[model samples]
Target: MADSAPDRYVLLLVPSAIRCQCRCVVSHRAGRTDSRLAARCAAVASVGAAVIHFAMSPTHWNDWMPSGVFFAAIAAFQLVWGLLAWWRANGLLLVAGVAANVGSAALWVMSRTVGAPFGPHAGEPEAVEAAGISVLLLQCYVVMGAGWALYRRCRAEEVSAIGRSLVLLGATSIMAVAVTVGLASGLQGHHHGVEAEAGHGPTTDEHLGDHHDEEPTAPGEGAGAQTFDHHSESSVVPGIVVVQPPAAPAAPPAPDDGGHQHDHHD
Candidate 1:
């Protein structure tokens, strides 16, 4: 009877043990799945930021050499990092990403609000434009995803493959819209800047044409030309004409003065 009791207990506990093991396996898988999704989302965000930086680098370079170089370097680093995360994201990489993205986003906010602390444009606040806003949004997403992965919160439930795909699709759509609108806004801004710079001064031909269209001043009307008459010689310039007064008759000879002195001597 004692042997039978032990056997019965062993049989009864087997199912519980099995259930516990299965739950552990499932929980572990769910955690892994959640972490993977976070990493992937972060990777996508990083790649999107890289694309925007790449597109803006040239324009920024045209405005300022340092800004262009900075953008280019950021683009390259983010691209490489994003690819690495996509391939295999580890804790160290996730931490690094979160740190970098947070710093970058902070700097962006500062630039838009107060101004950049250094560089040629120091203390000059930049406008909040579409490209910049898009980049900010992507950076924010990157930070959130990387932080989520690092913390491992909300990992109790398993997300299905379809759900992951939908998430990715939504993210991609947001990035695409941002990139498109941002690029368009940037191009328009550049075009307007060029036009404004060009419009600062009028061309010589246009200025001359404007003056030439005016009616000519009467010859003797102005104080400068009061001595001038209808017969006076004229000088011509591109858009102006000046009349020169005739010379006075040579002083009637001092010859008369020499004759008056000889009469006084007599």
Candidate 2:
């Protein structure tokens, strides 16, 4: 009878043991999932950081370039997007991230065309070459891909409301960039005009003074006559010898009378 009682006791504990095992398995799986999500978020943030750095490459992380402002704008979006992605602000992150990618692509295209994109007088090969076409295109894919992935997995409540509100910021930034280019071009023109005037002032005066000094000598014909003599002098002499014309034939007797008189005397 004691053996039977022990069997009953084990039977009573079996359910609890099974439940504990199930709970442990569930917890372990949950932990793994959380880790994966965290890792993905970190990766997303890292990509955002890369985008920010690449955008600033033209300006060398400074403001020397006109495109630096556009890059600054992109970096700002990247910062916000990274934070949102980390916090699982899926909606706002998606909204902002896609826009950022579009804007960045546009910026690259602008760089290839004119200095107007970077700033006034920035010119080609300098600002455009700041980031290679392949590298920038790759970045565009990364941003868009990450943003899309986050949006797909993110729940409705994951992103803050602010993200949704600021989604259009990307569009607004482009217009602001255009305005900046115009203003910078104008300023550059004004500055160049001032510099040109300053630079020419002294040079023009010096040139005028030099002309006045040479005025009296300008009409001299000696230079022209000498140039003509030099060209024809070579044709007259192969070496240094000057050829003389043969002596003219002796002149005929001037008068026959004088000749006859000389003959009679002989």
Candidate 3:
């Protein structure tokens, strides 16, 4: 069965939840003592690493260099401040960030082995690269969420922290899965729609042949017949013909740009 509009909308919400989770962690840790100090240091280091990484790459360096620098700087600041305010909390955040990076790098390696650079392409090979990147991002988001949960648990009142963290994690995970699967399904549906349109003309004969073995029904018989049943004391009207129209063609699937796959080449 095809995905519904609501399902696609839910899918688009997944990445947004992931992004919100990342921002929440950064924001929540911003005011903590160890978190502040660690955030600053981490920000600087992240910026430096990003600069070096961008410098090493010659292709579209101008386009990506700024973003790399920005994320690095943000990471460094967030990490330093977070660590300074709350050492344990900041540590969890750092670990999450590191795990995300490692996961992304692993995906990049897999893509290289498969001969698809982390960019758009024409076939399943290209799709594999895209899928790898999506999985990597999802993993990173999950880690960040886990870190945020840890931070919350560390700082909140003992009575409520654990419960709140569990709730947040559960909600985010459901959103993530729903969004990713919905978007992927939507993309697949689009590809199928295109193929169907392109191949529609010649498939009529094939379809007919597949259905040819069904037994023929006599006219005015079976469910196709119009009939009236009358009891001894009942009067019935006749001469009414009921006709069922052919079903309309299904509409093309909508494009989901908001859920567009992230490009994680660097």
- Could you tell me how far off, in angstroms, the CA of residue 26 lies in candidate 2 after the best superposition? 15
What stretches of model 1 exceed 4 Å from their correct place? 1-32, 153-156, 189-266
Candidate ranking (TM-score, best to worst): 1, 2, 3
| Number of the candidate with higher lDDT, 1 or 2 | 1
lDDT of 1: 0.75
lDDT by residue (tens digit), candidate 1, 1-266: 77899899999999999988876875567534776778788888899899988888898898789988998998898888899888787788988888888888899888877778887677767777788888889888888888887776334357788988988788788878877877777666532111134346888999877655545566555554322233434633343334445555554434564466232211
Using TM-score as the measure, the top candidate is: 1
What shift in Å separates residue 257 of candidate 2 from its native position after superposition? 44
Better of 1 and 3 by lDDT: 1
lDDT-sorted candidate list, best first: 1, 2, 3
TM-scores of the candidates are: 0.61, 0.35, 0.25
lDDT (Cα atoms) of all candidates against the true structure = 0.75, 0.46, 0.43
Clash totals in order: 0, 3, 34
* Winner on TM-score (1 vs 2): 1
